[model samples]
Target: MLGYPIPANETQRLAALHQIKLLDTPDDPVFDRVTRLATRLLNVPIATVTLIDADRQWIKSRVGTDTRETTRKVAFCSHTIAEGAPLVVEDARQDPRFSANPFVDCENGIRFYAGIPIFSSEGYALGSLCVVDTQPRHLHEDELAALKDLTDILNDEIRLREHLTREQQRRAISQRELDALHRSLEEQIERRTRELNLVIESAYDAYISADENHRVLDWNRAAAAMFGWSRQEALGQSLQALIFPHGVPEYDDATPIEVNACRRDGRETPAEVRMKSLRVEGKHRYSLFLHDITERRQLEQLRDREAREDALTQLPNRRALDERLLDAMARARRLQQPLAVLFLDLDGFKAVNDDHGHAVGDELLRDIAKRLRHSVRETDYVARWAGDEFVIVLEGMAPEAIQGLSEKLILTIEAPIQLGEMSLYVSTSIGVASYTPASNETAQELLKRADVAMYEAKQAGKAQVKIAQQGKA
Candidate 1:
């Protein structure tokens, strides 16, 4: 048993369809233009202008598919004509009516379908102008409007052809039929205009259209919401002056532009503006699509900072420090410069924590972190390796400079800390590890040797500096 939808006025429908005399005709470029425009504008690979027949569906024009017609019972366009409205199947496999349908079950996967009914002046649905995609997707309001406009253009072509033939055979067509076709053409133009307005109103992007001189022509609801300017206030204003007050934009596609988008309150926001060329009635214009990426950019920067930085003392974490270490080793080997890694552990740290409680211990660590960071040169990399321990990388330094820096670290830790209501003091055992172009120590091995020297400093009573035995490759 074949399942299909049939028009109630099948006789009248076929009479009107055959009157156009378009059945079994060669591919017309006029029809192909609508099909091509549908495929490109809607971003779908398959588009067709199918005319429904008694037992078959005929393709007047098509894109992507090789088949010229499909069985009426198995045709999606068959259902489109009966409904007499836009038929959108987001996923045919999910619909009970089409789940077991051969086209939906095929290897290519006919998942998405959107068809706009093609009509005659007598209100008969002759066929459909539709698009199909293998992948499932929902059509936005603007996309639906665009599809409808294309169908309206196709119907206009059909009516235009009928009108020309009627004029040539004036004796065959009644005066009443001629009057009806004239009225239909006028109504089609009015409907096409309304459809375009609907597309603009429902667009998600800040749809800003302007003249060649940059005067605003159309400001959509999205543009008003994004720029804090109502449609009435934005009309006739200079587009560049309204958004980019500092200077005209410098175009780059590498990244979305971070422009100073002047707000209604005279403040600025970081907006990403993507401009495109829009041609209206053979006249050139600009379409600016704006999105406020201020919050997104801030979150991106914060995430990057958090990934590399320690939350405790705001110093570079182990991961960030390792990156610097590898980079420093490469530069040191290239420039033939001396590089040093100083591993410092606070002496008597556990005893101080045990005596003063953990609260005092935390404060002491914070204060120590600040002092150690300030103790090194601005060019050096200082990172807290773990609790009570820190590592500093020094590049392009002489052996004498290394010795003075080691002494400076020792003195800085030995300095008294005024911790409210009393004075506190601590010292750090320092281990100095050096690498020159002549040395054979890898980055990790250098740190291991530095750890060995730090143990040696701890063993020979606390608060002393020890140098690692070099060339341990």
Candidate 2:
């Protein structure tokens, strides 16, 4: 069999094919629908929405076929891409091109074939939507036209999928950017972002002027550095479309906006954008100033995380725990449901730190923290209260269930922990404080009651739970 010839625009065709991003992608129902319809309408044993890669024809969607791919050198669809129209071979045995093809001699016994080239929007014939049968057959004029129509639909589906993926990604990135912009930045950012309102050419911030129609008219040097685009490449491009391909947002306020813009290398980078509308030479024009904000935002997030998280255990620290208690209490009060606070301290934890250095001690604390978190429901809040002290807020738990949960937590900790070479066992003294409107206790007072109960548990020979006395100091 004669090997299929590559198209004259092979390089451009391959580039266009990769731009669609359909090769080797997961099967989508959109492509499946076309292949399924082709199998039924044409009465062929096999139908496939095949994509020709650099070396193979990947079956994007196939009916009645297990072979996912074959070498492009031997693929019938490879030749179809060259035809730029429907390629019909009524009998493989009579066709010189495919007469000696192994597919003709194989178990597939492929004899009749009809393929319509699937062209990309740029007129690159990437592959084919084809039907194959074991027995020799002829497709009528109407059937050939139907195949072409199906390929046209397949082309639309391919283009739609590419556009939708980019749009979904764009929406996700935009949401993150807007969320960061709206959040309260600390004094440093507040001062910087405030003064950044009026950007001068001398400032490092990128200044750009675009027409009201969103076309870029002027770009500063900083703009080139920020977006990875040279002045020549960015000028005359749609500023709005270049920055936000989906569309300019209908912002909730006229304040400055932060967005991740597409760089020349296709990486999205966080940038602050301030826009103003004015008249330049009596022509309505818009000027925008931009500055990269990735580093600043990352520092903000890091500081925010550290402020509320335990340094050693990486669990919610005391401050976060206190906030959670206030919210949980309010929710319980509104619902008229009972909630419990369990305060626990590791029994003989100091002894372990004394015996095995603080490194092992730190690892033990982290391990127990994970166990405490896993033992409770997602609704429960687990936090490190202090050194060797842990607190948990279990909402909607009845008095009857509190003891069982407390016991489970103790037992969970008793399981041996693997810290390096040592398998160490630990026990806990837990205090249970159940909240009711009758008690009228503040969050701090509730925590104090739980702390007292924990001391009582320790007095009663440790490794046990002591429920706090209701309405008692």
Candidate 3:
């Protein structure tokens, strides 16, 4: 069997591929969903997200096949990626490229294939999302378009996963480099003192050497610039007074540790500190390396917030809502207080989308999210449960107050949303389900009850509030 021709930029492409480190790992549901969707949409028996490795095609996700991998010579995905575009074969038996291939010549072999190249952010083709069928078939124009759309989604997930993986690798590398530097510096200080001084002067991070009593013995340029003091001013000063005026962390550990560091102006900054002990000319000293980590901390916070927020509405997503529900239930049980969950579903949202467009509908949903947010108190939690649906968790609310709050939310949503010249209107049906200490219901049950009540509100004409009558037994 003839193998697909290797790409001209195969070396660089493989380098980018290996850097993502996705090969032969555990199954990821994020990629699994893409393959599953591809099978259902394309009506294929086999669908896979495959990365073309040096010798094999590794399946990141697969549906309708037990084979996790196949040789690159027999992989249609290999050819698809090699072409750097979509490859569609109506009947593999009739296609010269794969007619003689064992995958097609064997009994009940693959007869149809459609694959789209998945590229890295650097424009290198890394792999492909391909669907396979046992029976010969041709794809309609819409089917091709849908397959492409699914591939786009797969590419997005790949990019996000790659980015997060690279960030983690970078942090690990920084720690390893610091550890190596610490060991090398200790050896250099023991054998050659003058060379150690030159190394500290050219170092990237702030370096300070202090005596056993915490008096600064040596201050590098980085240290002077970081703490707003010249080398002359920092030398002989108390290291604690210069950077740890408020408090000091245990600097006995040789490994890196995170700590709050004070600047000359008394401003605080988070830093990664690594300490090394040295004996110079029979004098005891400690060398400290400080690296500012404010940017890293901020990036971590942003990533955490993004994971818990809905991109469309900037509200707490379903994951966050579930956590909030569990916490609220726990507090209610401890305090012996009452809590309520209000499930809201927007009415006439579909009509608005169909009448105007998705853009208008999106703007309207954002407006509704804002109105719903402002309609409730800051103590209450609002989450976007799904499209056109929201869940609000309220703690320590009386029955009368819960009812009033639900009514207020409905009224607020009923108001016209002005999107430039056009005014859009939508109402919400609220379902109220309260939990008491005696009830002792799970979060899922509470949400189900509220959801059921919401349907009742819809049944009793939209824009009405319906309270769940039965509590958990």
> Which number leads on lDDT?
3
1-473: candidate 1 lDDT, tens digit per residue: 66988889889999888888888999999889999999999899999999998999999999999989888887898999999999999999998878888989999879999999999877899999999999999999999999999999988988897787677678555666877787898799789889977887777767888887788998999888877899999989997678777765754445556676888778887787877766789997887777778788899999988998887878888888889999999999898888999999998779778988888888888888999888888999999888888999999888788878888888899898778975678899988889766667788888877888989999999688899888554
Query: Judged by TM-score, which candidate is best?
Result: 3
* Superior candidate under TM-score, 1 versus 3: 3
Screening candidate 1 with a backbone cut-off below 3 angstroms (N, C-alpha, C), the clashing residue pairs are none
Count clashing pairs, candidate 2. 0
Give a tens-digit lDDT track for model 2, residues 314-371. Answer: 9999999988999998988899899889999999788889999898888899999999
Question: Judged by lDDT relative to the true structure, which candidate is superior, 2 or 3?
Answer: 3
Per-model C-alpha lDDT, please?
A: 0.86, 0.86, 0.90
How many clashes does each candidate structure show, in the order listed? 0, 0, 0
Candidate 3 TM-score versus the reference: 0.57
Segments in model 3 whose C-alpha atoms lie over 4 Å from true places: 1-196, 252-254, 281-283
List where candidate 2 sits over 4 angstroms from the true fold.
1-204, 212-215, 221-239, 244-269, 276-279, 283-285, 418-423, 437-440, 471-473
lDDT of 3 by residue, 191-210 (tens): 68777777889787899989
